[model samples]
Target: MAQQERAIRTRRTILEAAGAVFDEYGYASTTISMVLERADVTKGALYFHFSSKESLAQAVLDEQVPFGAVPEQPCKLQEIIDMTFVVAQRLLTDSLLRGSVRLTVDQATPPGVDHSGPFRQWAERLIALMEQARSQGELLPTVQPRDTVELLVGGFAGIQLMSRALTDRADLAHRVSVLWSHILPSLAVPGLLLGLDSKADRGLRVLSAVPVS
Candidate 1:
């Protein structure tokens, strides 16, 4: 058991080190030697977990999803809003997520590495919530769940990029809140709009509300 645990820790350390390097150097310029130096792990150890640099980068890219017990809300729209805020809040400090995001947007990756997974995954998650909102009569009659989700996901990608450039994403939560304010009116029913929480600190509140595991 102890050996297994240690192996897991070693794997996490290597992945994080790779992520940090990828974040700094991007895919094309990031080499296995760079990751080894950052991780301070032997080549044998890295090869045991990841066969190649592409695989390591893909692992980091796949780690983009946020993990936690975010309390589910009765209003699916609110739940969706909270989800965005949570990501925005975490992006401020989480190096793994930051690295994943950088890889997702970087255009220099080799042809085999796909960065579209995160976007598709986010779109699918949001579409599921939007569908639930529609069933609950929370969404506007004209709002199509898939369409709204696509627009939102694309808009969010752009918003985060702008925020990253402007303030290193320090203002991302606020920008996302502003985005929801403009988008919710068009997406949600009137009654739901008034009750939804789109505040900037909502991400912090949502995360804090989760009991420590």
Candidate 2:
């Protein structure tokens, strides 16, 4: 058990080191040596975990998902808003996530890399929630889930990028809240809008309740 746990730790260390390097120097310029130095591990150890820089970057992108928390809201639309804010909050503190976003938007992404996977996954999740919201009468009759997926996913990417540049993501939760505040009233049913909680602090409260995993 101890040996398995140590292997997990080693892999995590290598990923973080690679992320910090990629976050600093970008994917193209980041070298294995840089990661090795940051990780303070031998070449064989890193090779055992990640074979090449492309794989490391892909792993970083993969790290973008699979960890988050939000309270169960009566409205799926509200849950969507909560989901975005909590992730924005995480981007402020988690290097793995921050690095993933940077890698996703970095102009020099590698050929054949699966950078689209995360976006697709997010779009699919949003589509599912919007479909649920529609079933629950949270959305207007005309608000199609497919269209909502496009708007919410694209809007979120823009909001997060702008926040990262302008305020170093310090205002991400607030900006995300502002985004929902503008978009929700138009898409949500009047009855649902009144009950939806899109406050900037919603992320903080939810994080406090469930905490990030």
The model with the greatest lDDT is: 1
Candidate topping TM-score:
1
- What global local distance difference test value does model 2 have? 0.82
- Locate the minimum summed-lDDT window of 10 residues in model 2: 65-74
Error of 2 at 188 (Å): 1.1
Residue 44, model 1, lDDT: 95
How many residue pairs of model 1 clash at the backbone? 0
lDDT of 1 at 111: 79
lDDT of 1 by residue, 115-156 (tens): 888889888888888899899999889998998889988898
Off by over 4 Å in 2: 211-213
Off by over 4 Å in 1: 67-69
Candidate 1 is scored at a TM of: 0.95
For candidate 2, write residues 1-213 as lDDT tens digits. 998998899999988888788877887888999999999999999889888888888998998765445677778888888888888877877778777878877878878677777788788877888898889888888887887778887888888888877988888888888888889878998876778788888877778888434
